[model samples]
Target: MIYKRLEFKNMAGQKVKITEIPVLDSRNPHYFLVHARLQALAAFIYNNPDSKTSYSFHDYLKRKMKWSDFIQLYRTEQYSHNA
Candidate 1:
C-alpha cells in the first residue's frame, strides 16, 4: 500500500516530491535489495551536510522507505532528465 505524498530535500537543496511510499513487506523476494538501497540512501543523507528533508533520515526511513518507493522516485527523476 503506497502512502501519501512526502517531500525531501536533496544534497543540492532542491525540494523533491515523492508521491508513493510502499509498505515494507519482508516476505517479498527483493526485500534484501530494497533494504540495502534504503540503507544507502539513509547513509548518504546523514553523511552529507547539505542533504536534508522535512524529517531526519531516520524518521524518513521509519515512515516512508521501501523498495517500490525508491524505484519509483529513481525512475521519475531519471526520465524527467531525459525528457
Candidate 2:
C-alpha cells in the first residue's frame, strides 16, 4: 500500500495534513469498497470542520478502515447532522 500525503484547508480554516492515504490496487477484489470509503472519508472531512483537528480522524485513517466500519461512520455522521 502506497500512502499518499494529503494537505488541505478544512472548513474551519485549519490545515489538515494526512500522511497515510493508501493507494489501493485496482485489481483488489475490494477495490470499489475501499474507493467508496475513501470518498466518504473525504466528504466527512469536508462536511465536518471539527474533524480537521480531531485525534480520531488522524488516528483512524492511519489504520485502514474496513468497508462496513467506514460506512457505519459515514452513516453516523449523517444521522448526527440530520438529528
Candidate 3:
C-alpha cells in the first residue's frame, strides 16, 4: 500500500490534512462505490484531522475510481448545477 500526506484548502481558506492510501486494486468489483467513498472521505477530511481517514483525493482517484468515471461524474454534476 502507498501512503502519502496531502494538504488542501477548503472554501474557507483553511488548510486541511488528508492521508492518501492506494488500497484499491483493478480486481475490485464495486467500482461505483468510489462515489460514496469520495463523499465520505471529503466529509471526513473537513472535520478534525484526528477524525479523518488515512487517505487522500489523489489516492482515491488512482485506486478506487477510474479517470473516465470521475470525469463523467464531475461533468454530470457540473452540468446539473449549471442547468
lDDT of 3: 0.55
Q: Identify the superior model by TM-score, candidate 2 or candidate 3.
A: 2
Residue runs of model 1 more than 4 Å from their true location after superposition: 4-20, 51-83
Candidate 3 per-residue C-alpha lDDT over 1-83 given as tens digits, one digit per residue, 9 for 90 to 100: 44445567654556766665334555654344754676677676665455333445665666656778655533423355567
| Candidate 2 similarity to native, TM-score | 0.54
Ranking by TM-score: 2, 1, 3
- For candidate 1, lDDT tens digit of each residue in 1-83? 43445466666666654344444468866457555755576456545644334443334554555656555533433356567
Candidate whose lDDT is highest: 2
Each model's lDDT comes to 0.52, 0.59, 0.55
What does candidate 2's lDDT look like per residue over 1-83, in tens digits? 35566677777788766555556578855567656656777677766887435333335643676666645434423356567
Error of 1 at 77 (Å): 24
Q: Which candidate is the best by TM-score?
A: 2
Looking at model 3, report the run of 10 residues with the lowest lDDT sum: 70-79
